[model samples]
Target: MATKTSLSSDDWIKAAFRALSSGGVQAIRAEAIARDLKVSKGSFYWHFKDVPDLKAQMLAHWSSQATDAIIAAIEANDGSGREQLRLLVEAATDDRNLAYGGVRTEGAIREWARYDSAAAAALKAVDQRRLAYVAELFERCGFCTAFSRSGANILYGALIGLEALASGELADLRADMLALLAALLQGGDSSQA
Candidate 1:
């Protein structure tokens, strides 16, 4: 039996995030989340105007927690481009997940984006922001503009791929990322074993 408890908006969001993690967009129903949190249906209405409102807020929360916060933390390190790049790699390859939600949640959001224009737009913005920061870090390391963008794409693509595949070999990916970073910083466009 689930006990009824008062849930704040953040609590609802967290429950929603968990739901999103497990079942994609379809799983984010008010009834489902309320049941999961053992809260009343009224509790959800208290937090959000409606389902669309909740979804929009979810996207905003995801964007901030997943991309903005990571970049800010890395920048705050006051490290060189290469160092920041390394940290970024570390952040991506960490054992948890992308940043907020794990691979499944990311995949869920992406899946949702395909059918919803708003989700698509939100995802596009997140991608652009993430790509831009990676490019900036690469440029700070003295890479040419084209190469920086390319490197950002390559790295970002690799992370997305890993998440898509739900691969669990972080240790190997970390090694590969470091090797790739070394090659990249050394004026080589390709990575070697």
Candidate 2:
């Protein structure tokens, strides 16, 4: 046995992320990552105990980044409750292209969850935080608790649907959905002043 060669976690992470995002969670193989980095499997093993270990670390990293965005945006808003919520919704909807616009891990994760409890758990946690954030935004904007919570779910669902559709005929779908959501939040119906 030889001492494992040195390699940065970031390099492995980048390769892993690209593989997952481009293909799916199933595509995240240690051998593939090693190939992507032009390194030996020892390098991946040196950083991660196994594929599951890599998945766990990746999920944790994604959760932190996503949660931080929500927290930071709220902190920076510093305005009326409605205004703050507005900014959050905007931020949540901003740049659909970068936020899994044309592609998504939804289907992949759903399948993986059958055999991968860790991935399932990670997805559930992320979704809870997302729904809670949206619900808070709706509540701050003076909506009733029940309606706000339900609406938050609806809003999130719509976002995901639009993201899926953005890959096909609904190319302009994101813009349309954003406009509709903004209007509703601003207290204007589909047809009103």
Alpha-carbon TM-score of each model against the true structure:
0.84, 0.76
lDDT of 1 by residue, 1-193 (tens): 3333555676777778778878778888999999988767877888799989999998998898778888888989988998999999887667545333555677778889999999999999999999999999988887778888988998888777666555454436666777777767775334311
**Candidate 2, clashing residue pairs?**
none
RMSD of each candidate?
3.7, 4.7
Candidate 1: the clashing residue pairs are none
Model 2: per-residue Cα lDDT over 66-115, one tens digit each: 56666676868778656765566566555532433123544344456667
Measured by C-alpha RMSD in angstroms, how accurate is candidate 2? 4.7
